[model samples]
Target: MRLLMLGFNHRTAPLELREALAFDNERAAAALHELRQRYPASECALLSTCNRTEFYLARPIHDPPTIEHLRSFITQQTGADADAIHTASIHREQEEAATHLFRVSAGLDSMVLGEPQVLGQVKRAYELADGCGAVGPVLHRLFQGAITASKSVRRQTGIDQGRTSVSSVAVAFAKNIFDHFGDKTVLAIGAGEMIKASLASLRRENPKRLLLINRTQQRAIDLAKQLELTGTDHGGRAWDDMDSLLIEADIVVSCTGATEPIVTESRFKPLLKKRRGRPLFMLDLAVPRDLDPKIGSLRNVYLYNLDDLQQAVEATTSGRRELVNEAEALLRGHIDRCMGEIRHRDIGRLVKQLRQRLNDIAQEEQGRTAKKLASLNGQSTEQAVEDLIAQHNHRLVNKILHLPLSQLDRSDPDASMGFYAAALRRLFDLKDQPDMPMDEASSDT
Candidate 1:
């Protein structure tokens, strides 16, 4: 088995490049379908968020996909600039890929360290890929192991002691902007988990008004009820009225699942006159960015995207240094265990192939021997003699398999069993060659 991971994160790429490559749920599902079409024998899962966009793949070691292929695929799917993708990409293979994923799932690599939201994001990504039938044994095992490691870290350490998510950091930024929210009108666009988390954090600040608007009004209404925003100052509003609400909003947080910008310069430029130059604090927390980049240029507007919030969140990583170290150690242990399991699984596949090949050979020879004996005797064999012959054939096959099976089972830390497995495959011609005809391949016993 071989694993490949190629993508960019907040540390390696700018927000513009990351946003250009980010995949929402629908886009991610479609990309997975395309990947399957392009590489049927391979497995893939895509994990895309505001801070990162990653593609994880599993293929036969002999049939690996190159970094260039992944770059081309992502560019084609997202229509991102090829040069930007190439410049910002970070590639990992085999165990390194596994380790990266483990760290990501456990929130060790998040912009806000030990953030709980990324673990859920990882699970959602795995579920989405699995639902699309893009995940096979390798990814299923890898993601599940990563999730288990994440849960273990959360349970074992105090890494999540204080405000530790992007939403919380956004809230912190809001607080720094305003001494209090009593006089401010807070308008949150879209009702995703991140928006809800941000709103929840803001609710504690006791904003004068909280308004939520979503493309699907029902979701906004449901979220409003869940957050208990039943008062006159807080409630769910219709999508058609969002523009008017935006004009009145003093603090705006927009995080939607939209693939394109919802608030553009042209749309908001006309609304600026209605606000009469009142300061607007807007946060665009969505991955394809619900708010347009050009809107940040407008006067009397303080705009912040994910990258800006990342800078502000970095300073809040105090008091968790020891916990972060402990989490990393735990993640390393998990990575080692996961890699060991993958190796065993790979070896098991080879062992099964060898056993089936030997069994097929034995069965074919036994059939030939029985036919020859019958022809020589010119009579059918008795049940007792047939049973005796079958027992003798089983004993002979076991004797032939014993030495190689024993060698495979030998534990040698200095030696790689992969070498032995590859030798066995080459020696027996057990794995079909690339040039071999499909119909001519030996049938499994």
Candidate 2:
């Protein structure tokens, strides 16, 4: 089987493109099924997140559905422009595909380098595909390897030692402003993922209270329940109560989906007197910015947007460059080991085929010998003698295989082993099995 990975990530595509291609769990499940239908024997998975949308496929090396076929499928599925996708996406095959997945699972390709969430995301994607019967042996091994490699890299390197996520960085900045969250009230104004992540990071500080509010009050309540924000002190509140809550809130994290700013300066400036000059730290993690830009001008209002959070993340990442290099090397080693195992599996299959072939030939020759002996003597040989002859043939076959089998057992499961397996297959006239493509475009349509 050949592996093919095609994707658009933060570095390769704009947010609009990523958003357009993004798939929720239900959509992802449906997409996997559709991909299976389109390429009946192919194994497929779709991984869609805020900053990326990737498709990983494993199929016969000479299959009908190639990279272009997959691209067309995606275009039809998502209604994205073919030319735009072609320009923004990347295509990788075989080892390159595996390498990219390893990087992604390890958060090397994330906007916030070494972020932990991508590992879970990768696992979830794999599970989703597997659940839909879109995963086979090749994908099962590849994804499992990626997940394990991610863990190994994290355990071996300092890349994930500190706060790496944007949400965590925002919380770290909040720490710089406030000595502690023990007496502080944190009001999170949204039920979106950014708000949820920010709330999770903030929860570690054990804040005095967490107030959740959304345009839809029930959504805020549902979010509170999902986050396990129990107790009367940490619960959802009405959107209309936001103004009153703002007076008591020491920190406000807003990441709503509104096209315009949710907290305008005009609406918030009058509430400042109620605060009595107390500092209010605000983090705006929304795409269009939930907090108005002018809110930063207000006295004692510390406003930081997504760009600010990204800067903090970048600063943290910059200091870990050496650690990242170490992580990269670790990932490469894991990939090598994984590839070796796959090659070893191929060799094992070939060996099984060889053993079966030899056994079939032995059985055929035994029947022929029995017929000739019976004809020569004009009587059938005794059952005991026939059984003895059969035992001898089995022993002879085993003896013939002993040296090669022992050599194969001792051989390292590396490129050299792959070469040996190929040579043996050719020598024995065994059925040809496709290895992962060597050429970058070998699996192209």
Candidate 3:
């Protein structure tokens, strides 16, 4: 079987396209079944996250699914034209697919390089696909190996030693501002995508109160409910009473898509007076920041724009470039190893076929000799015939294995052994047989 990985990621597509293609668990499972139906050779698993959407498949090499087939699958599931989105998608075959998956699982592919959450997300996606019965041996082995490789990379490299990115930097800034998040009241402004990611990061700190404040009351309520369901230690509250929520909030993180600032100095001046110099840590993650630039000038008000957090993140990432390079080289080595294993499996199959062919010939010759001896043989003649048949079988087996054995010894240890094994099998017309032990056949070589 040939392995395939096709999808779009943060590097290949913008958030707009990624969001359009994102699949929740139910949708992803349904899509997997649909892909299998559309391409009989495809044994598939769909992985969709905020940063990426990918499909891992194993199919017959002779009838491998085409780029057009993958495009159609995506178009049918997402209602986006394949022609328009195809440029954003990448196609990987066999070794490339394995390498891509390893990097993804290790979080090297993340927008925030080496972020830890992505590894968990990949594991969850694999589990969901496996539970849905959408995964077969090839995909199963590939994902499992990818997970192991990811763990190894993380353990061996310092790539994930620090927090970087707007959300993470915001959380770190919070820690610097407050002794404990559990004692601070958090007010989230707008239900933007980044806000959701920020909340996921913030929730880990077990904040005291997690409040959702959006222009739409329903959106705020929905976010509050989701945060609650995700088992956050914080008590979640909707911002139907926005004034009261704002007045009470100790920290505010805003990531709205508004063209202009949502919270000006004038808006917070009265609230700051009412709180009597109590510090308000405000993170304005919006590109055109949600908070007014003047807010930073207000007393007891700490307002940081996206640029500040971005600078911090960039500094951290720059320091870790060496680790990133090391991690990448490690990933490449793993890809090579996995490909070598796959090639070895193929060679083993070929060897088994060749051995079976010789066994068939030996059995046939022994049957013919026994039949001829049946009419005239004493016990000694029958025994002699059996010995002669055994000797011929040994010679035949030796001749068939000679070339493969030499190649196996001399060929690059990391190169595919399957090609030579397959050649031997095809030449000998050896059909694979059931109930044969691999070690016994391999030992003969």
**Best candidate according to lDDT:** 1
> Model 2 over residues 1-445: C-alpha lDDT tens digits?
7789999876787655765777878988999998898789889988876567899998877885788988898899889899989999999998899999999999898878888877888999999999999998888899999999999888888576674788788788898889999999999999977788889999999999999999999999999999999999998999999999999999999977665678888999999999999999998766545688888988998998655665577776776778878889889898998777766776787799878977777777667666656665644558756775777677667766776665577444543666766777888999886676767457574
lDDT pick, better of 1 and 3: 1
lDDT ranking from best candidate downward: 1, 2, 3
Candidate 1: tens digits of C-alpha lDDT, residues 1-445? 7999998999999988887888878889999999898888899999998889999999888874677898999888878889988989999999999999998988888998878889999999999999999999989999999999999988898676574678777777776677888989999999988889999988888899999999999999899999999888898999999899999999999999887899999999999999999888899998778999888889988889988988887777765788888988888888899889888999999999978987877777677667656665645558756765787677667767777766787575655678877888988889745875656666531
Superposition error at 28 for model 2 (Å): 0.5
For candidate 2, the lDDT comes to: 0.84
lDDT of 3 by residue, 200-288 (tens): 78888877778787777677667767767334533345545666766778888898756567887777677777776788899886644
Q: Which lDDT value does model 2 have at 12?
A: 82
**TM-score of each prediction:** 0.81, 0.65, 0.60
Instruction: Please list the residue runs of candidate 2 whose C-alpha ends up more than 4 Å from where it truly belongs after superposition.
Output: 171-186, 189-196, 200-209, 214-233, 238-312, 346-445
For every candidate structure, what is the RMSD over all alpha carbons to the true structure, in angstroms?
9.9, 11.6, 11.8
After best superposition, candidate 1 residue 345: deviation in angstroms?
A: 1.4
Model 1: which ten-residue window has the lowest total lDDT?
A: 436-445
lDDT for 14 in candidate 1 is 94
Quote the lDDT for 89 in model 1.
94
